[model samples]
Target chain A: MDLATCLKKMELVGVLAFATVDSDGAPQIRNISAIHYESDAIYFFTARGKNFCRELLEDGRVQILCYTKYKEMIRMSAKAYAVPEEEQAKWRDIIFEEQPYLANVYPGDTRSIGIIFCIDRAEVEYFNLGVNPIFRDTYTLGGGTITKKGYNITEKCIGCGKCRTKCPQRCIEEGKPYRILQNHCLHCGNCYENCPVKAIVRE
Target chain B: MDLATCLKKMELVGVLAFATVDSDGAPQIRNISAIHYESDAIYFFTARGKNFCRELLEDGRVQILCYTKYKEMIRMSAKAYAVPEEEQAKWRDIIFEEQPYLANVYPGDTRSIGIIFCIDRAEVEYFNLGVNPIFRDTYTLGGGTITKKGYNITEKCIGCGKCRTKCPQRCIEEGKPYRILQNHCLHCGNCYENCPVKAIVRE
Candidate 1:
């Protein structure tokens, strides 16, 4: 529903899938749970020698995704960076304290080979499919910006109701321009492609 | 355990997370379930206008990930392409037949707007965290080549057994030049980082 609720849902989902681009421009993904969540940011741990670490260092752009049992998808798009050298240990310790299972993977001094990366700003998208028409929205954490999407009806609408009929969610309503209920829109582009007068424009 | 079995597991898991690189080289991900699987290949459907489709058209590279409840992660790294024009309808029909729920989303003629993508060759990596020492291995489907990973001990091994002690899996054996049991290896690189004689090399 909001940035805080989305972050809470991600934490409740536990392990999340993180995606990043490799040097070859190919996408790589792995499940990661060694994370410490803050009110406005997230810090996660990865071994320094791992490809996951190299990918993060070479390309800070990353996407974290989680699908809850209730069919809610919380996706965070952000750039990740290694924590400040002086603060790495603090964050790493906090994560380790939270995820005790990590101790089995890197015991004792071996943890020194690990590094902590932080995502301080992100555009969090919350998409819920559990309801009838579906619901979606974007929120910013730490002042991050969101990319505008979906379709809008222009004033050129002849009110033929073609777009409304084709809309899967039936979110379009009768008006001067035929209002599209953004909250329930699927962004499936059905209405955009079916508009007879070409009045719908992508936002 | 093998490529075929892994594919079956993914089918059982239903919706999978697909990760791709956008035109700006940033990572993007979405959940996809409109899939049809074969013994050696996979076919999936997505809207032609979605960013996921554009990314595939531009870069072809993709990673399909599914995490099972038993803690097994099956990741398929491959290149995807729009099915040939003549064959698109065939694959699309098969997928829609397999996934009846798709009808609710794109009823009647609306399904024509969707495009079918295929991955005929892939390198599948199976990591099972549900087991002790974390079993992992890679397999190829449709004659795909795999990028070797993890560490190997070279002939320069001094047999000091330091590598074995540091190995979390204890999979390294004492020998003239220590051998790493690839099947049980965690690939954490602890043995490689601590090798005093620099006998370890990444595969």
Candidate 2:
């Protein structure tokens, strides 16, 4: 439920899947083992010569995922930034010390090509499928926002009450335009599809 | 390895991460448990009203990923299409039978809202991180093309030979425009970034 618990679960995962956007505008993903944990940030290193590095530099947005044996998945999305020169050595040393195997890939002098990046602000979604009806929740750290998701009603609503009859969650509130309780929303576009007047919009 | 071995490893993963492009063009990922594998296709079911279902209906492009306990990753990219309405009942029954837990969520008549999708032509990538230097390979099934990735020389090559020296895979061949062995290429992009004339094109 807390970041520490999430970090501990991720550590058990051993390897993490990191995703980036390639030059061709397609999502590229690869496994990485150079991740290090900090009190408030997730740190990872990549060689400047790698496409993964170039993608990060071109667009800082990234999503890293780890799934544990317990059938729980923690997915974190953040805007990544390089560790500044002033603090690179500090974080790099901490990371290198934790991930000793990295030395095999970038030995001695070649280590200079390594770049350290930190995701200071992240939107983390913890999902558990261990139960019958899967559970999921979102957490924001370091000022990241948990954007509102699901369908919304427009002012054009005829208040036909058709949407209210079909909503599985029944979290819709009647007003000039029906409002959906996003936190309880299943993101099931039932109202959107069944609305006769087409007053629903994906938010 | 063969697709059989790949699917077995995927089964051990228990859950798979499925990626779909949202209306905003950003990749959205979520855990799925209703997957059923076949000789030439992978099938999964989702509620017709879910955003995930809408995404697949709007754009058939999809990517499904599974990472094993041995630090191996099998990612498949494919075009998903709904099972023909005539065959939906057959496949849906098979899915519900295989995944009994699904009936708990949508018991009785609610099960009709579930939609089944099949990915027949998939480009699969097998990646291993249990060892140093890492390892990766590509596989295609059902007539899907294995795409060429990494860097390539352009008309501006200038034949400076700087890139050839920097190539780590040693898969580059000498020519008017140096060629990178598509299969052996690591996609590290070392040559792409090291080109003195910036003549490398990333595909």
lDDT of each: 0.88, 0.76
Instruction: Summarize candidate 2's per-residue lDDT along A1-203 as a digit string, tens digits.
Output: 77778877777676777776656555566677788887688888787767788889997778788887777789887889998898877777777788886665555644555789999898888876565445667887787888666678999899888877666556578877888766455566767878899999886
Per-residue lDDT of model 1, residues A1-203, tens digit only: 78888999999889899999988888999999999999989999988768888899998899999999888889999999999999999999998899887887777767777899999999999988767678999999899999987789999899999888887767899999899999898777888888888999986
> What does DockQ give for each predicted structure?
0.61, 0.28
Candidate 1 lDDT over B101-182, as tens digits, reads: 7877777877887899999999999998777777898999888898988788999999999988887667888999999988
Top DockQ prediction, candidate number: 1
What does the lDDT read for residue B94 in candidate 2? 88
Q: Look at candidate 1 and tell me the lDDT of residue A161.
A: 96
Considering only chain A, what is the TM-score of each predicted structure? Answer: 0.97, 0.78
